[model samples]
Target: MSVDRVRTAAAARGLEIEIRESPRASSLEEAAALRGITPADIVKTLVVKGRGDQYLFALIPGDRSISWPKLRALLGVNRLRLPEPELALEATGYERGTITPLGSTRDWPVYADERMTGRRVSMGAGAHGWTLFVDADALIASYDATVADISDPIETIR
Candidate 1:
């Protein structure tokens, strides 16, 4: 049902999206391998808990980590934490391995890092082994996501 909803939404917007199935990717490196794309192209979705137990989703580049202080400032909250896997699944209708910003049970306020602009990115598809690819700009526009600098610099190993 979640997958179908996402497909329907994409179709309504005339987005030519591709859903690919593969062995479950537990990390960005594995996801990149499964999708045949570089790590930079995979968009990682994180469920964060803000003040008053409110939850929001942040879409960030696979190669980066969320800057909690920056995100908290943007959200106007003092602190934030990653939700437990069970809570995350309950809120998004997707397990830890399959949470995407699209088609969540709630219309979550989405925050995308500035690095995602003008790129082709891949995200989870409501199930393990399935992934959805779309234009980063289109995704933000369709979801009414706010663009911000929410990532901490990650050094790449040579």
Candidate 2:
């Protein structure tokens, strides 16, 4: 049902997307490897809670992490946090790992890291054991997402 929702949403936007069944991986790197792509090509759809009941979807590359200060300044807000899993599900109609703006129950605003532009990226398919692939530029246009440098490269433990 969730995947169906995703399909319908994509169709409505005239955005072509590919949904593939995948075995759930334990980590971001592994997920990318399984998909035969670099970690950077995997986009993470994160739910960020703003003030009150407001929330937004952040599309960050897998090899990066949200830069709180940068994001705050970009949004002109002093506070933002990742809400609890239950709250995320309630907000997006999809669980944490399966959350994508395409099929969300609510049309939350989307913010995308600039690095994700000009590439085809894989992301959540609104269901477990599935992945959705789409052109990042098209997705940005489809959602009217704000594109900026709102993320930092993920530091790896040496």
Candidate 3:
């Protein structure tokens, strides 16, 4: 049902996408291998909290991490924080790892890193074992996303 919701959302936008399913793996590297892509190609959809209970989806490449300063400056706000897992599910109707802007409970603003553009990116498909292969340009245009340099290389990444 989750993946179906994603398909429906994409269809409504007239954007073409390919859904790929793989066995649930133990780590990002394992998941990438199962999907026949490098970890960097895997886009991580994050549910972030802004002021006054507001939320936004932050799309970052799997190998990079969100830069709080960069994101805050781009968002023109003083504070931005990530929601807890439970709150994230409530905000997006999907678990942390399966969250996507495509079929979210609310069509909140989407902020994607500039690096994601002009590439064949793999993103979450509303299910842990499923992923969506999409053209970065089409996906961004379909969502009217705000593309900017909101991420920086992780130093001692967690």
User: Relative to the true structure, how large is the alpha-carbon lDDT of every model?
Assistant: 0.84, 0.96, 0.89
For residue 138, give model 1's deviation from the true position in Å. 0.3
Cα error, residue 146 of model 3, in Å, equals: 0.8
- Residue-pair clashes per prediction, in order, are 0, 0, 0
Model 1 Cα RMSD, 1 decimal = 2.2
| RMSD of candidates 1 onward, in order | 2.2, 0.8, 1.6
Spell out the clash pairs found in candidate 3: none
In candidate 2, what are the lDDT values of residues 78-105, reduced to their tens digit? 9999999999999999998999999899
> Top model by TM-score, which number?
2
Residues 1-158 of candidate 1: C-alpha lDDT, one tens digit per residue: 66787787688766767887767657778769877889889888999887665888999898898999999899888889998898898878888867887778877789999999999998878877688999999988887899999998787679
Ranking by TM-score, best first? 2, 3, 1
Model 3: lDDT to the true structure: 0.89
Candidate topping lDDT: 2
Q: Where does candidate 2 clash, by residue pair?
A: none
| Model 1: worst 10 consecutive residues (lDDT sum) | 19-28
The alpha-carbon deviation from the true structure for residue 6 of candidate 3, after best TM-score superposition, in angstroms, is 0.4
lDDT of 2: 0.96
